[model samples]
Structure formats: structure tokens, C-alpha cells
Target chain A: MNDSVIHIEGLHKSYETSAGLFPVLKEVSLHITRGEFVAVMGPSGSGKSTFMNILGCLDHPSAGSYRLDGHDVATLDKDALALLRNRTIGFVFQGFNLLPRMSLQDNVALPLIYCGVERAERHQRARELLVKVGLEKYFDSMPNKISGGQQQRVAIARALINRPSLILADEPTGNLDSHTSTEIMALFESLNREGITIVLVTHELDVAQHAQRQVHFLDGRIVNDHATLHTEASL
Target chain B: MKLAMLGEAWRAMGANRMRTFLTMLGMVIGVGAVVLMMSVGQGAQYSIKQTISAMGSNLFVLLSGSSSTGGVRSGSGGSYTLNVADAEAIAELPGVQAIAPIHPGSAQIVYGPNNWNTSIIGTTPGYLDARSWPVASGNTFTDSDVRSATRVALIGKTAAQNLFGDADPVGQTIRIRQSPFVILGLLSTKGQGMDGRDQDDTIIIPLTTAQRQVFGSQFPGSVRMVMVQTTTQEIMPSVEKSMTELLRQRHRIREGLDDDFSLRNLTAVADSAAEATRVMSLLLGAIASVSLLVGGIGIMNIMLVSVTERTREIGIRMAIGARQRDILLQFLLEAIIISVIGCFIGLLLGIGGALLVELLTGTKVIIALSSVIVAFGVAATVGIFFGYYPARKAAQLDPIEALRYQ
Candidate 1:
């Protein structure tokens, strides 16, 4: 637990619907140490999304403990949780959530704005990341002007802007073609090789092969957790 | 951080220019109406104050009682009940500052080849003191001028202009009813009176000269009216009561009989006129404030719609670690930018409208700096006040639910 990036125990999450209390995650426990790239995989309504939300500190579990980067998220208030997420975890959503009105550089620098970074430093850091993502020439272009793969690359650059300990990608390549998905996975693999921990949620078996380990969920429970056996073959 | 948020707010507004402009139109019209109405009302009040000051302060006009011949009564100044002695007697009373015996009429004056008809006032030198008038170019007629019935006269600006054209009238001789009178001084311009009459289109001469030498009064030393002034406004009531009692006693009238003269507190009349103008300005401001309120409501409505429309954007910001306060600040800043920019535009439009009104109607309009500051302050306050609810609603949104919203 000393070197763990994500530590959870008996985590339970439920939604109060109009009819009754609907349980999504029940009695779940997971531990992911630093520098580990893990994939969360499940069919629809298998609670993988809820588990990823808890790991990202975006939502609190109904009952149990969740410690992300050494902070007990359940004990934190809403603002504190937001701060924790800003400083410790980065999120890449299925929909490339780049603000439509902002330029690509501004979209990448948005997270720094919440943490009170100065404009010149934010611009410099965003430029570095956009260059790292190979979209440095399109810094001033709007998100709509970029292709799906390029927008996703920009989203990845935005996720890495704050240098967070953990990258939480929910279907990071969900909207991409197979070739584009392979490129995104290669980017994630290169990032993970640089010692940043990544926790991605995807149902595709080939996408999950990129991660060092894969955790599978079924009926609100983890049914399988194992190291990938076909990483070399898939690559 | 706030400055960055303001930039974000500005871009957000720039995203939908048409919607933003329509929303800002309400504030524009509202602030425009307020500024314009305030300017017009202040102009009216300022003109009234000028008129009041021109007429004089703490003044009273005592008109001689009307004469009745078999129930056909004349006006208050139609009889010779008031005279120069009565004015001198009133001067000795306590709280009395100055007194002027006046006999006024209209007559044709001739200077060289120019002949013009103008008002002629026969008054003592105290009239200038009571009216707070100053000589513009030459000396005023002295008390000795009145006592010896001199033909020295003071020419008003309008009368001087009409009689002498561009030439100096100080030493020129003007004939009143064919009797030559030397112009002693040029009285300063008083512009227009409250009754819309040109106060500078008149002349002033010695009371004795007007009564004896010019008009030839039947009763010696009797004048048409007496103008009295008190030392302070607070002493006017007591002075009026004492003067009434003194006049009644001096005239030897019985207790139940009416006095032989009528006294009017000109200051009170002027004060009421000023008060009426004050009320009128306040009413105009209140009416304009209603439009401001409607504009504020319009801002609130648009902000609410904006919040609703931008729910998904809010969710996206929250997902990336934006706190509730950040969201709130962003939206509030948007609202404030819209209103403040609208207020600035409205200020320009209002000043332009006021100047246009002045140019069209030839009315005086004053756009005081304090009024501009107040309009700006109120507009900013209205923006914050109306933008609060929508901003708070955006702040309190559930991130998970907002993220899922289409």
C-alpha cells in the first residue's frame, strides 16, 4: 500500500432510482501500485464505468474506502476532491470533451486555469504537450477543425497538462477507427513506458492487450484479474 | 485566475453573438432611459433653480389693495394704497434686509434712429440688492438720484441691444415718452424668467423720476408696489406677520376690516415651484427605474437560459477538475461583461439622446458626472444581482448527471 497509486477496499456504490436503491458496484477491492498500466473491461452495465468514476475521484462510493495517490477520497469534500483530481489524476473521456469555442491550445490549458497557473506558463506548458502529441502546428485551430484522431490526441495532451500521477481514460479510443485506435494505444503505451500509471476502461480484447494487466467485471463484481498473455503477439 | 475566467467568459459570449446581443439590448434600453431621463429632469431642476436665483431669495411683493367702485373691483396693484413712505417704514422693521418701491409700465423708447418698445421699472437702488443683480458695465442709479428725481437710467442687455445695436449705451441718451434720459449703466443679463419672459428686456430708473417726472402720479409719493427682502429665509413668516400688523395699525383699519394691501411671499412661491420640479424629476427617475428593473429581469432570464444550454460544458469543466466556484465565476463574469458593456453603450446613447433633445427643443440639458457614475454602479450591481441565481444553479450542478446530459 505504500507505493500504491490506487487503493480500494470493500467499495460499494448504489443509485437511488424512483423505484428503489439500485446497486452498481458491490464489495469491490482493488490495489494498483505506481507505474502499472491496468485495463478495466466488462460488458454493458457490468459496473466498470462506476468503478472508473470512483478511481478518478469524480464520484464517491456509497460505502467503503478509496485512496487515490494517498488521499482518502471518501473523506474529502466536493472542492477538496476536485483539487485532489486536479493534482493527482487526469481524465480522458469517450467524447473528446474539448470546449468547442476555445482554440486547441486553450482547450489543452483549461485544467491549469482551474489550478491558478499564470497565463504565460500555462501557454508554454500547453505548447510543449501539444508538440509532444504531434499537433503543434494546429495550436490555434478550433477542435472542430481537427480530425477525430487528432482531437483525441489533443485530449490526451490536455489530460497530461497537469502532470498528474494517474491517467483515467474512459473509452479513450471509443470513437476512433481501428487504425486510429492502434495509434492511440501506441501513444498510451509510450506514456506508460515513461512511468506514468494508466487505468483505462475498454471492452475490446485487443485494446486491453496493450495494458500490462487486465481486470474484468461481471454482475457488479470483478470476475477476472490477470496479466495479459498476448501483449507481444498483439503488438 | 479571475482575469483568465473573464477571458473565458468573453469567448463564451463571443460564441453566440446574436443571442448575446439580444440579451444585452434590454440593459441598453434600460440604462439609456435612466440616463436620459435623469439628464432631462436635472435640466428642468437646474433651469428652475436659475430662475429662482434670478428672481431673488427671501423676497416679498406687497401690492396695494384693489379699488372698488360700486362692486366693480380692480386688481391688487390698481390702487394707490402703497407709497414710498410705506416702503421706508417697512425698511426700519426687524429682519428686513432691503426695500424697493416700484412703479412698472411699458413705454416706447427712442435712441438715435432706433425706436423700440420695452418694459420700464421705476425702483429705488435697493431693488438691485434685493434681486441680487449686478451692473455689467456702468454704475447704478444712486439714492440721491431717486431723491432728486434724476433722469439717469440703467439699460438691460436686451433693451440696450435693441436700442443701441452694437454701440455702447452707457453714456447714450434714450427718450422715454419724449423725455430724454441718460443711460447710467448696463445691467447684467438675467436670461429668461420662470414665466418664459425675457427678464433682460427691461429698463430700470429712479422711482421718483418714474412716478413724478414721467407718469405724473395723482397722489404724491404713492407707488404701485413695494418689494421687501428679509435677512434670512427662516424669518420670513415672522416678518410677514409683523409687516401685516404694522400696515393694519398704520392705516388705522378696524380689527374686522381687511387690510388695504396684499402681501405675497415670493420666496414661498419660488420654493413651491422648486419643490414641484424636484417631485417631477423624482417621478421621472422612478418611471425610468421600472425599465431598469425590466432590463434586469431580462438579464436574469437570459442567464438562466444560458445556464441550461451550457450544462454539458459545465460537466466537461468539472470532469477536468473545475471547482464549483470556478464555474460560478465563469458564468457570473459572462453576465457582468454583457451588462457592463451594455451599460457603456447605453451611456453613450443616452448622452447622444440628451444632446439631440437639447438641439431639437433648445432646452438646457446637463449630464452631470455623478449621474454617469451612478448609472454605471447601478448597472454593474444589477448584473451581479440578476446573475447570481443562474450562476449558483450552474455551480451546484451534479457533475456525474451533467456529464451524462446530451
Candidate 2:
């Protein structure tokens, strides 16, 4: 428990619709240890996306105690939660949410701006990350001027700019082709080997195979949790 | 961090240059009109003050009674009911500082070949002291000159310019009404009178010289009008009352009979004129401020649209850990930048417009630095006041819902 990066017990979330209180997640509990890659699998209405939002600290659980990197997320105020998110978690979305008006370099340096980094150091770090992601030539290019794969690379670079302890991705390759998706998964695999914990949501079996462990959700409840057979066999 | 956010804001505003300029147009016109109107109004007030000061302070003009000849009555100052003796008596009163008895007329003035028609003021040496006027060159005519009824005169600037050109008029002789009078000194210029008359286009000579030698007064020692200066403004009413009573006694006027002279408070009339100009200046500024209000509203309107259009960008920043204050400051800075920049351009335009007005219409326009600072300060405040609501709305957006916005 002390080494765990995320620890949730009896997490429950609900929405108040016109029909009344509609529960999305019910009595679900999970834990993710450091340096581990976990994939969450579920259908569209199985509460997996809500679970991802909670883990990212973007939304509050209706009735649950959530601990992220040993901080009680439910107990923290808005500003404290923002600071925690800045320091501990990085998010990559399916839409590659890069601000369109900013250059690729500025988009990658966005998180560092929140961290109060100086402009020179921000540029230096962003340059290094862009070089690492094979986007060394597109530093000043606007986001719309770049391809989808290159834009996703910039988003990943932004997620890593703050040196977060955990990376949370929601269907990161949902809009990418198969070849591009494989290349992005390879980047994630390499990042995991570097000892950064990663949690991802995906319905594709092939994408789930990239993670060491898989958790399946059904009807807002966890139905299975186990190591991937490929990983087990390799071990 | 703030500098970085400002850069981001600049880029965001640059993204829609047309909309930004259109929004700033309102501020541009607002500040421009305010500055121009303030300058013109202040210029008018300034000129009025100059005229009042040139006329002298705490002054009164005592006009002789109108003359009735066969049921056709002439206006006030038509008869010789006021005299030098009455002026001397008024000078003995408590608040009387100085007195000058005047017999004024207009005649053709000739110096060599140059001739001009100008008004003439025949008064004692006390007239200079009462008007607070100084000689620009040479000495003033002495009391002995008045006693001797000498034909020595002081030439005003416009009279000197017309007769002497650039040459000094002192020691020169000018002919007034075909009589030679030596120019003893030059009176300093007093640009214009309250009645739009050229005050500097006149000449002053001794009262005894005019009454005895020039105009030939029907009643010896009597004058048409008397100019009285009071020690302070507060004692004017008492002095006026005393002068009236003393004059009536001297003239042997019966009870319930009208006085032979009437007094006019020049200071009160000038004060009212100044007050009217002040009110006009305020009204002009008030009318211009309406446009400023509209400009602020325009900024608010555009900011609301920008906030709605960039909802997803706000969510992206929030997801990367931007606080509410960060988002608020960003949008607020954009609004302020627009207004301040627009104000700068408007300041230049206003000053240029004032100069153009002065050049074309020959009207005075005073562009005071304090007014410029006030306009700039008000514009910045309007930007902040109107920008707050939209910025707060952007800051309070839910990151989850904002991210999902199309």
C-alpha cells in the first residue's frame, strides 16, 4: 500500500439525470503499484471512463476515498488538487488536445508554464523532448500544420514535460491507424520500462496486450483482474 | 509566468485580428472624442480666465445717469453726472483701493503717413494702477502731467504696431483728432476684452488733457464714468452702498428719487461667465463618457464570445494544471491590452485633431497632461471592470465538461 501509486477502496459515482440518481460506478476498488502498466477494459457504459476521470483527479468520486501517490485526493481542495495533478499525473487524450494556436514547442512546454519554469529552461526541456520524440524539425510548426501522429507525439511530449510519476491515457490511439497505434504503444512500452507508472483505458485486445496486467469492467463492476497471459508466459 | 501568460494572450488576440480591431474601435473613438472635447473646453475656460485677469479683479464701473432730451433718453454714461470730485470722495471710503475718472472717445490716429481709427481712454495716472497694467517701455505719465494737462499719451500694442511697425513708439508723436500727443510709454498687450473687442487697439491720455484741451467738457471737472477698485471682494456691497448714499447727498437728491449714477460689479459678471464655461466643459466630458461606456460594453461582448469559442482550450489548460487565477488573468490581460493599445492610438489622434482644429478654425485648444492621464486611467479601469465577468466565467468552467465540448 505504501508503494502504490493509486489506491481506491469502495469507489462509487453517480449522476443525477431527469430520471433520478443514475449510478455509473458501484463499489469498485483497485490499486496500481509503481512502475506497473495496467490496462482497463470495458464496454462504453461500463464506468471505465468515469474510473479514468477519477484516477486523473479531473472529477470527484460521489462516495469513495481516492489516494493518488499517497495523497488523499478526496480530501484536497481545488487548488491543491491542481498542484497535485501538475506534479504527479500527466494525461494524453484520444483527440491529442494540443492548443491549435500555439507552436509545437509551446504546446509541449504548456505544463512547464504551470510549474513556474523560466522560459529559457522551458524551451531547453521542450526542445530535448521534441528531439526525443523524432519531432526535432517541427519546433515552430503550428499544431494544425502537423500530422495526427506528429500531434499525438507532441501531446505525449507535453505529458512528460513535468516529469510526472504517473501517466493516464484515455484511448490515446482511438483515432490513429493501426501502424501509428503500434508506434505509439511502442513509445508507451519504452516509457514504462523507464519506471514511470502508466494506466490506460482501451477496448482493443491488441492494445491491452501491451500492458502487463488487465482489468475488465462490466455493468459498473470489476469482473476480472489478472496478469496478461503473454506476460505471464514470458516471466 | 505572467510574461508567458501575456505571450499566450497576445497570440490568442492575434488569432482573430479583425474581431479584435473592431472591438478596439469603440475604445479608439471613445478616448479620441473625450480628449478632443476636454482640450477644446479647457482652452475656452483658459481664455476666459486670461480675459478676466487682464480686466482686473474686484472692480466696479460707475456709469453716469442717462440723459433725457425732449423725451428721447440716451443710454447710461450719456451724461456728465459723475465727476473727478465724486471719484475723490469714493477714494476716501473704507474699501476703495483706487479710482479713475474716464472720458472715452474714438478718433483717427495718425503717425506720419500711417493712420488708423482707434478708441481713446482719457484718465488719470491711477488708471494704470487700477487696471494692474504695466508699461512695456519708457515711464508712465506722472500725476504732474494730469495736473499740467500735458498732451502725453501711452500707446497700446495694436496702436503702436499700426503706427510704428517694429520701431519703438516712446518719444514719438502721434496725432489724435488732428492734435499732436507725445507717446510717453507703451502699454503691455491685453489680447482681447470679454466683449470680443481688441483691447490692445486703444490709447490712454491724461483726463485733464482731454477734458480741458481735447473733448471740451460742458461741465468742468465732470466725467462720463468712474472705474473703482475695491480692496477685497467681500467689501464690494458695503462700498457700493456708501458710494450711492454719498453721491446722492452730494447731488442733493430727494427721497424716493432715482440716483444720478449706477454701479456695475465687473467681478460678478466675469465670475458668472467663468461658471458657465466650467459647466460647459463638464457637459462635454459627460457626453463623451457615454461612448466610453459603450466601448466597455463592446469589450465585454467580444470577451464572452471568445470565452465560449475557446472553452476546449480552457479545459486543456486546466488539465495541465492552470489555476482559476491563471485563467482569469489571461483573459483579463487580453482585454486590458486591447483597451490600453487603443487608448494610445486615440491619444495621438486626439492631439492631432486638436492641433488641426487650432490651425483651421483659429480656436485655442489646451491638451493638458492631467487630462490625458485621467483618460488613460479610466480606460484601463473600464477594461478591467468589464473583463472580470467573462474571465470568471472562463475560470469556473468544469474541466471534464469543457474537455468534452465540441
Candidate 3:
């Protein structure tokens, strides 16, 4: 779509292994528009993680181009790309990746620290986001002191701290129980309803069902890109 | 980045409290050792100067230059170019307060069954005035003692103690070289000199008595050295100049030739000795700096381990939009903070160590603020130098690789 916030064209990635050259992604092009909730699903060894890495600006594509928020990701320098990522994108890992030494509020306020936000204002926003995620009581608690579900919720609060338009959650509920997973999926649905674009990676079809659009990856290429029949009301 | 970044470093350092404390201990001991070494050395130098200048700071000795026999030159002080006549001339010069023509002789002093080997200095009454010494309990020698060439003598406190025990040596007869000499008085105690020699282990007698009685054959007007006392310390140079001119005129030495006599200032000797001590202090300071270097290496070692241990954390920060420079600064700042804290603790420990040294050794150790400032400046520089590798290692990590680290 012309309103695409993330536009990928002829994207490719490779690794120079000791065994020689190894190609991971081949001619994988995808577009993610604003305010869209999308799921990227694939089996293990299918280069799904590699694709996610490139999309997060944590890795560079060997060839071809990828654009995020209308900025050319391939041409931007490391610092400029970092600035773009800081302003426009947030990440959620399967491990919940909350800094264990920090309090929940501080973990949530971490992204804002890079943004040069004042201390009081960062804490204020972190508190507000925590309350929104039903983690108001755990604001001062450390991540390891809380449950897996609470940690993931805190991570989501962290992702939203900088008010980024796009969120990339890689298996957000991968380590959570089935019940906690559904609760997290429900939270993602609510965030999606609030018009924030989210692109998540999951192996479970049940988790992928929560997104409005599902893109299936096989052998490093997209095999299926279609809208999901399930709605937020169903979840 | 933000001031918030500094909080992260503080918290990170705080999280490893035991390790932090151990690391800081190295710096503390290093700096303490350096400061203590320098201060104690300085104190020793100060005391040495004081002791060297104790007798008479402006005292000047006119020593005869070396004499040549055929070709081999005898070292200075072995020659007898300086005589009583030169001393008499130097005494008449302006700014000359007192002059003592001293001739040194060694004798076995025997008081009843007690016998002791001591130096016998034959000088006039002006010697006591030049030395600023007063008789502690008895009278000094008179000018007639030198004129009549009497065998009467003045004993030093140490000699009196050794020969007469506790009994008063004054008015008692002490036999020297088998000749009975009455002890006129006991000289005051002057303690040990700069060269660690007992200043009071001697006796004073008339130059005429030493030449006629002790020497048995030496010339009547011969002197080993002449001690010239100036009226004021500031006029010492003028007195020395006049004395040199008078001696040269008396010796009939030609121009463009070395004088047959040389003058040595005790103040100059004291200053050179003090300079040697100052050099020793600087050497000790340099040696102590090795400990600071070792301490810095400890910091680098721990910082590297920290970087490796927190690889995943670094990845998370990068993934969340922390730039490479940010990561670099975070780790670098952490190292700097550790060193800064180490330096602060070290300063206190060093000052305390100096005071403890002074208390234990009875030496006054002075702590210069400039030394503290230099030590802390070195610490900061060391932190930056040693911390760079590990901080760079953290900053150079690929986010993808770091996140994948276990």
C-alpha cells in the first residue's frame, strides 16, 4: 500500500560461515502499512528470525532495500538508523527482556532515557503506561520478582513508552503458559484496536490467529499473505 | 544521551558491591603507599637540613688545596698550605666575627683506671664563640692557655662520661699521651651530627699545647683548617671573598692560577644534601606509581569480564535504540565512576596512612595537596586508558549476536 510505514523491496540476507557462503533470505519483499496488526509465522529453520532481525533494524540486509517509516534503512548510517528506530519502532522479545536489575517503572522508562526525556517526565509516562497495562501495583517491583505474564506486560509497557507507531514482538508469549498467553494476546488485540501498528512473529497458529493479517514464511519467502477471518470481538 | 545514563552506571557498579570494594582496595593502597613514601621522605630531608645547620649555618672552613709531589696529586685537605697567619689575616677582614685555627689530634685519655680514645681539637677560645657553645657546668679555656701552652683541657660531655663516669671532670686531672692535663670544663651537649658522628665525643685544648705536647715536633704556626664565623649569614659571601683575596695576597699567588686554599660553605653542603634527599623522595614516588598501574590493570580485567557477562544487556539496550556511542559511553562511564570513587577513598587512606606513619615513627610527614591532585588526575587518566578496550568491546557487539548470547 502507498501508506506503508515499512516497505521492503527485493530484500535478501546472507551469512559468511566458515563452511563458506550461506544464504538465508531470498527476494523476500513485504509491506506493512500504518495501523495494521500483522503476524509473521513460520516453522523453525525457515529464516523467520532472520527476517525479523532485518525488520527490527538490528541487522542489515546483504542486498536489496528495506524502508521503515519512509526512511531508507539501507542508506542510513548506524547512528541515524538508531535514531529512527528509537523514534519509530519498539521491540518485544520472547524472553520478555526486561532489565532484571531495574524496577518495572524504570524498565518501562528505559527507551525514554535514550530519547533524552527528563527523569520526572519519563517516570510519569512509565507509571501511566503501567497502569494502562494493569501493572500499576508492580511499578516499583523488579522484573524477576514478578510472574512471566507480568514481565511480558511490563515489556509491552516498555515498548509503548516512546509512543512509537510500530511494535515488533517476537513470540511475546513464547515462554508464558496457555492461559497467560491468551491474556497477553488479548492485551495485544486491545493495543491493535487503539490503532497502533504491530508486527509479531509466532510459531503457534493459535497466536497468529490474533492478528488482523497473517503472513506465512517458508524457506525464507512469504508463501501466504492474507487477512485473518477472526476479529477482535472473537478474541 | 541523558543524565539517566549515569544512573545506570551507578546502579551497575552498586550491583557488584564486593567486587567494587575489592577493586577500590587496590587503588587505596597504591595511592596511600605513594603519598606515605613521599611525605616521609620529605620529612627526613627537612630534619637532615635542620641537623646539618644546627651548629652554625653560616660557618665557613678554609681548606688547603691539594699538593703535588713529582706528578701524583694529593687530594685536598691533605696539604698544609693554610697556616695560622692566613687565619690571622682572614680574621682582620670586614664581616669576620671570629676565627678559630683548629688542629685535630687523637689521644688516649686516662682518668684513673678509665681510658678512652677520643679526638682532641686544639683551638683558641674563639672556637667556643664560633661554635655558639657555652660551658654546661665548668669554665672554658682562657687565651693565656694558648700563650703559655698549658696542658689544661676542656672535655666534651661524652668524653667526660666515658672517662670520669658521673664524677665531675672539671678540676680533675686527665692523662693524655702520658702527660697529666687538668680538665678545665665540660663542653655543652651537641648530640649527633648530620654524618651520624657524636658531636660531643671530643676534648678541646690550646693549639700551642697540641702542637708542642701532642705533636712533639710540628711547627708552631701550623693549622689543619680555619673556621671563620661571619657577623651575619647574609654577609657570608662577602667574608669568603675577602678571605680568599687576603690568603692569595699572603701566599703571593699569581693571577690566572688556582688558589693554594679553598673555602667550603656549610650551608651549600646542607643544601646539596637536602637536594639528594629530595631526589630520593621522587624516586620513591616513582616506585610507588607501579602499584597504581597494577591497580589500573585490575580495573581493566574486571571491566572486560563485566562486558562479556552483560553482552545480552548491551544487545537489549542497542535494540531499544541505544546507539553504539551510547553503549560505549555507558561502559566507559562505569569504569570512570569506579576509578573516581577509588581515587577518593585512596586520598583518605593516604592521608590517614601518612598520619599513622608520623605517629608510629615520630617523623613529621607533610601531605602536599598537589600530590593528591596529581594522584587523582593519574587515576582518571588510567581509568580511561584501561577501560577503553572493554567499553569498545561492548559497543562493537552486534545486537543480533548479543541478543542470541546466553
All candidates: DockQ: 0.75, 0.73, 0.57
lDDT, candidate 3, at A194:
94
Question: Model 2: residues >4 Å from true position, as ranges?
Answer: A232-235, B110-116, B161-167, B233-238, B241-258
Q: Residue A143 of candidate 1: its Cα lDDT?
A: 97
lDDT by residue (B253-309, candidate 2, tens digit) is: 999999988899999999999999999998999999899889999999999999999
Clashing pairs in 2: none
Cα lDDT, model 3, residue A117: 90
Considering just chain B, what TM-score does every model have? 0.95, 0.93, 0.72
Residues B1-406, candidate 1, lDDT per residue (tens digit)?
8889999999989989998998888889888988998998899889888999999999999999999988999989988998788888899999999999999998999998999999999999999999999999989999999999999899999999999888889998999999999998999999888788999999999999999887889898999999999999999999999999889888889989988999999988888998998899889888987888888889899989999888999998998889999999998999899889999998999999999999999887989898799889989999999999999999999888888888
User: Per-candidate TM-score, first chain only?
Assistant: 0.97, 0.96, 0.96
Q: Candidate 3 — which residues are off by over 4 angstroms? A: A232-235, B53-60, B64-81, B88-192, B197-223, B228-249, B252-272
Model 2 chain A scores worst on lDDT over the 10 consecutive residues at A226-235
**Prediction-by-prediction clash tally:** 0, 0, 0
Query: What is the DockQ score of candidate 3, to 2 decimals?
Result: 0.57
Deviation from native of the Cα of residue A184 in model 2, angstroms: 0.6
Pairs with backbone N, CA or C atoms under 3 Å apart (clashes), candidate 1? none
